[model samples]
Target: MAEVEAADFETAIAECGFGLFNVFILISSVPCLTAMVFSAATLSYVMPSAECDLKLSLLDRGMLNAATYAGMIFSAIPWGFIADTMGRRVVLICGGWLDGFFVLCAAFSQDFLQLMVFKFIDGLIICGPFAVVVSYLAEFHGKKHRAYVMLFVGLSVSVGAMILPLMAYCLLPVHIFFNVGQLQFHTWQIFIAITSLPSLLSGFLHMFLPESPKFLMSQGNYNKALISLQRIYALNNRKSRDSYPVKKLTDATPDRSDVINNPNPRRSRQERYKLAKKKFCDGLMQLRPMCSSPFLGLSIQVYCLHFCQIMCVNSVRLWLPQIFATMHTFRIRGMNDTSMCAVMDHNTHGRPIDTKSMEEECDIHQDPDMYIDNIVVAAVGLAGFILIFPFLRIAIVANHILKVFLFLSTFLVGGLYFSKTTLTTLILSSIYLTMMGVCATTIISMSVVIFPTLMRTMVLLLIMTFGRLGSVVGNVLLPIFMQISCIAPFLWLCTLMTIAFTISLFLKVDVQQSLN
Candidate 1:
């Protein structure tokens, strides 16, 4: 192994140059991550419509969602290894291509089974970007600013969350366009394909972007890493200084053969510590030896976090629209069966006087304004992640207790049955929002921090896969309990969160400190 000496660095970044490149990279990657989240979250909206239009059974719908997760669960480990072995750029590019292809397939699917298969495959392939992007961004920046930079990643996904409903509303008309005779391609297919263009553009842009300097150093490409860094500085229009202030690698930069054949270096702690400071810049790309070790404790912690977090988030996200619809029945102003019928007719876009009206009538749904107000409860969940960030140094045991209490309280309170009164619905919906928002942000951020760099891809994909499974569970329960007591779905969500709360008590390591 060779060492990357400090004498090799060149402090060439021009004023305002580095900031622009960083922002450019962030802008490109944010949408890539955002699209990933948006597609997953919006699937619930698409599935039922596809099912009803295609006359698929409830079992078929459940299979579609489950199929998506099943593919994800199976593909993650290998894909992570690929990202580790081949490179993030290749995997990310392929991920974008696969995402575009399968989404188009799903939109064009003629039968329920076809849609199921395509979605499953898409889910598996799309995860490559999600897992790789974090590692990609983490390597470029200093450790001091990692958390704050990652916050942008979180906000990007939040933006995705906000826009997903609008996309859903816009594309819902795809079904209507199906009845037309002139168009060769259906509207849904066009919608899916259009959504994928950003990913395609990202893939091309990534080619021009410099490979992670640390990754090159990890592969014993010290000369290449030097060249790449110089190019980065050039692109940023920074002055081409003779050398950089930072050392490129510590713990010895392994040769290409050595890295490929041996990811884990059996080196002494003294040797590792010696390189720690010098290699700080390049260390971001170095995989912790334990990442591949069979007995690694961090791996287990991340797995549990991913599994539990996804289950809770997906369970709530899939149920939100229904929850709001349930609350709508309680509205008081100018409400009557006739008005409800008229509203349903407007929403459904139909003229069938009696039969169609009988099948699906509205609750004289109030202004969609109420939807935003009631859903504020979920904001508490989102807030919890941000609030807990500064205090994350506390022991996991203490954090575990608060997390459990937060979820259990929300579940129990939100699950309680009450008259369909407008006020009661408003209050309960708020609780539902809080529980879900907090659970999602906390787990997602925690997952990124906990997983070892090498296995990040695997852990994230597994988390998302489980989350999709949760959505399937919710969707499946929807039709069964749709006719039963109105409170059944709420009870199911409460139980799922309670189970997650119990699971959190067993974990110990905080991922945020894994690198530290």
Candidate 2:
């Protein structure tokens, strides 16, 4: 028999046939991504109702809101290193379960301090799946389908956001309370437990999935990589493994120079310690290339764009419920002619004009408009994703689309500042946030195509670290800025979006071409 040719990694992946496995991977990712959104966003709904329960001041609310981002910022580097060194699947499964546990713990929190601690831990763990899943899902697809699959998963973020408000609307209104020993449980606590389910479910779903075949190949484990491909081929094509094509994968060199060369397992304790030390060193060394030469410039550009994009999107997103609540209060007070700034002034006054009269002011049940407005914003974002899905296939469309979205976001932020009525403010804020979110997902898709596999997760996590820092900064500064001048935060967001728009222009156009 003639000698068969060994196929390259991309060729082997393409031959796997995108069918059952691809859909499964995509479906699995929705919960992973949604869990991330839920973890970050749960506080937005919890804060308003839990205010009386938790004794939360405005500054306390801001700190609790920023706690997740603060934890994520600190943990990003460590998670990146672990994901790259171990495997993407390991990070996803372990992180998802731990995050869920912490979120559930948060539901049992007796006070603001306890909830803050739990939320921070939730942030610490959830960063793993949030950064690693992008690489994991993309590795399953060939170039032709990679971008489309990523965008579809990105849409799940909007889906998660939409689901949050609906869940809040349903659960926040119900009067549920119980006594668990010395602890008191309320409806908000149940709301939090329900939100944790997604992370737990995501971890459970990922238990059956295989490690990325590309990561295996990068580690020079060709046999295991081939086995993974065969499994995927078998599942995707509904065929026997024996009938799958591409029996061998080419011995492609690792893109990363520091691919760990595992030592023999029977080594002595002292030798094992040495090996562990060497592996740790190797992991640190892997980051050097990203900070130098060709990668350095690309890294800086993407990091900046990510920082600005996340800063604008998450700042507005995490606080949208509060913004809507303010709008709701304004409407109830018959201040229909007031701008968002005027509403902020009303909300900031430390004392109520008449305690009895203002008793129903911040109550979400009385003002379903807050939840409805948030649902509308999230739905519009979801719709934007659906509308843009068709254009994602076009060559280099991500770049142009990103630029256009950022540009529009700038104007939307400005328009939001000038918006005088509730209707106008909601409309402009929805479009602004939707645009910023789309830009964020577009940048993530671009990163998958632009960076090599070995460093992809590390680079992504680092990018996200800066992005989370931006979120932390925005969350912490927003209240301060609002107190100084309501228009100040809007102007600040506009400036950030404008800078991000300029940075988007510098991103390599070849990213889309690489996908093609």
Q: Please give, for residues 1-516, the per-residue lDDT of candidate 2 as tens digits.
A: 222368887788888878998888888899999998998899988777787566567788889989998899889888998888788999989988998999999999999999999999999999989889999988888878887887887799989988999998777867778998999999899999999988998899999999998888876777778789989989988888877678777755543322334446688999888978987887777677887878899989999988988888777788778777777766666766568777667656632555454456535333555688888998999998899888888875766888988888888877877878878978988888777777888888888877777788998898888898998888888888888987898899989988999998887655554421
For residue 383, model 2's alpha carbon misses the true position, in angstroms, by 0.7
Q: Number of clashes in every candidate structure?
A: 17, 0
Instruction: Give the whole-model CA lDDT for all candidates, comma-separated.
Output: 0.54, 0.82
What's each prediction's TM-score?
Answer: 0.71, 0.95
Q: Highest TM-score: which candidate?
A: 2
At residue 489, give the lDDT of candidate 2: 88
Overlapping backbone residue pairs in candidate 2 total 0
Off by over 4 Å in 1: 1-4, 7-18, 47-52, 170-191, 231-237, 241-243, 257-298, 322-413, 416-438, 447-451, 466-492, 506-516
Clashing pairs in 2: none
Cα RMSD (angstroms) for every candidate in the order listed? 8.8, 2.6
Model 1 collision count: 17
